[model samples]
Target: MRKPHFELPLHFMLLPPVIIVLIYSYGPILGLVIAFQRYVPAKGISGSEWVGLDQFKYVFSLPDTMNVIMNTLSISVMKLAAGLVVPIAVALMLNEVRKHVFKRLVQTFIYFPYFLSWVLLGGILIDILSPERGVVNAMLGWVGVEPIYFLGDNGWFRYVLVITNEWKEFGFSTIVYLAALTGINPTLYEAAVIDGANRWRQTWHVTLPGIRPIIVLLMTLALGQVLNAGFDQVLNLYSPQVYESGDIIDTMVYRMGLLDAQFSVAAAVGLFKSAISLLLISVAYYLAYRLVHYRIF
Candidate 1:
């Protein structure tokens, strides 16, 4: 019998990524100690005095923390719902259309937004939604309705965030659904047609079932990011006027840590958020596996 032996050089293939992961990913985790200590950049991580959970204590003591968490969850959940539904719906709609040129044009237009940075979109959004001179306001004027303050109003801020996020990201999600849609065997449609099934029924029984697994997988991955409510978008689009409804955990961390220079408190808040996200992701992954028998790794 031949001896079971692994190729030595094959193992070397993993070394570069392992080293990169350690340097880039694991290296930053070591700085998590700052969550327990009042870290000064000059004094360094070693010199900082430990304050234990006092940072966490301060975090919960704030009245705004509840609002911040609420904003984060609300916006994230809304975005997730929109992102999941709209893309699938759009893909289905596109699939129904017979004109290849029109379909491709629509796809290109939708996907264009995904490539635009929040910085660029922020200015465009502000210009389009500006109360005095915005296109939206002008349209509302034509309809004899009052112009709404989308960015400044606390009540509308979170809604706008969700909408803007969806507008930017829905195209990417649509691409995934479109890919999944294409993978569906055409024979299923032919068989359905032979059985006298119409387009609606064929889609219901064949297309949806074919893409259901991909949908579940995407949802599982999205659930892992429930806490990340678009830091860049929120940071750019929001102002002090709407902080009550617009301030997410990431923006709050940015403000407290970088702007206010409260390193320990910021780190503690970040660590707490990360822990919750990990817990949520684990639960979501397990549930997904139970439901669909899938694993990412």
Candidate 2:
């Protein structure tokens, strides 16, 4: 048989991204060695003394480590659940809109927030959620309620994280679900309608079933990020006052690695997070494929 020609241009198109990933993503993996070494910048990676798993042990011994881990898990899980539910609900409501122009406008408005950086949103949230002279407090004063410190209070801070994270990201997530909804067969909805199904019934049976694979795919992908409770948002929004509830793995790592100069312990904690995330992602993919026959790739 004759050899077939390879598409050179098509392969060439992928070169830039491939090179970028190799340099930026895969290249930095070499630094993972620091996890096992008592890393010192003055001595450098080569000269840093190898401490084996001592860093890992130290990480486990720290009482704050447990608190940070718990906070990370709690915040991430709540965000994940809210992220899935709120976006799906919003997409469904959008899908129900018969007026195309209005629906598009609404979508544009909602999706606008996703384009804003966490730095910007965090500042805006601080102002809006301020206990004094903020919009929320101003409104509460009307209803004869005391001003509540949403960002500073340990009890309310995690909830604030979840809500703000959802508010910022849900719009983009809704767009994904909306795209999935568009791919659903219109005939299925017609059939359901013919079978005397109402709007809610059609959504529950036909619409949801049609989008099941996408939902499964997203959920499976999200499992890998169960430990990532958003570094930017939390770092920008949280303070020492709410650190008990708001301090996550990333923030803890930042403090240990950058501020406190405990580089090895920080790397160890990071490696632990990566391992857990990998395990969770693997399990999630397996369950999704076995249960729903859904594969993202």
Candidate 3:
């Protein structure tokens, strides 16, 4: 029998990421103690007065807390649903395109937006969505429709968040589906055609099932972010006018912790969001394994 060789150089290459994770990710966990204290910057974590569950109590007592939670869940769920469907549809359509140049051009154009930061996109959206002279409003004016205040109106803000998020992200998401589509057995499609199955039938029976594992994986990962409703995008685009619809848990934490200088309350809210995300990830993992027999690990 041959003895296996250990790759010492490869092991050395992994050390930097391990060190960074220890310094950044795992090291910050000790600060979670602030959530249980009336944290003061001058007093420090150890010197701060311990208040136990008081911070959490205060968080739950606020009337805005429920609204924030609802907004976060609603926006996240809408983004997740749209994220999944649009990418899959686009990937399927792209798969049917025989012209390589056109397909590649489309993919390039779509994928480019994902690389642009929300800060940049938010600025562009502000100009494009401007009620007075924006392109969207200008188009509406041409159609004899009233100019919609997309970012300012409470009724339309959440929809804007969902739609814009999907538009920016779907291209990157499609890459995963396209990769899965490539992995599908070509013989399966040939067999489907032999059975008199049309393009739609072949897609329904073969292509979807071929990518089911990837779909389940993406969905499970999305569940882990059920509370994260794009803080950067929302913060950049929303004004006081749409706060009723756009204020999410993360933005609340930013205001309470950083702006208001209530570190304890911020920590408490952060801990709550983390707990919910952890619970969701665990449940998603269990469901994926039990129902679909898919294991991310």
Q: Estimate each model's TM-score.
A: 0.92, 0.92, 0.93
Best by TM-score: 3
Determine which window of 10 residues in candidate 3 has minimal summed lDDT: 287-296
What local lDDT score does residue 79 receive in model 3, on the 0 to 100 scale?
92
Predictions: Cα RMSD each: 2.2, 2.1, 2.3
lDDT of 1: 0.92
Tens digit of lDDT per residue, candidate 2, span 177-294?
9999999889998998999999999999999998998888888778888999999999999999999999999999899999999888888999999999889989988878886787
lDDT of 1 by residue, 156-227 (tens): 888899888889989998888998999999999999999999989998999999999989888987898999
How many angstroms is residue 171 displaced in model 2 relative to the true structure, after the best TM-score fit? 1.0
Candidate 2 similarity to native, TM-score: 0.92
> Candidate 3 has what TM-score?
0.93
Q: Which pairs clash in the backbone of model 2?
A: none
lDDT of 3 by residue, 1-297 (tens): 999999999999999999999999999999999999999899899899999999999999999999999999999999999998999999999999999999999999999989999999999999999999899999999989999999999999999999999889999999989999999999999999999999999999999999998898889777888888999989899888987999999999999988999989999999999999899989888877876787767
The parts of candidate 2 lying over 4 Å away from their true place are: 1-19, 292-297
Pairs in steric clash, model 3: none
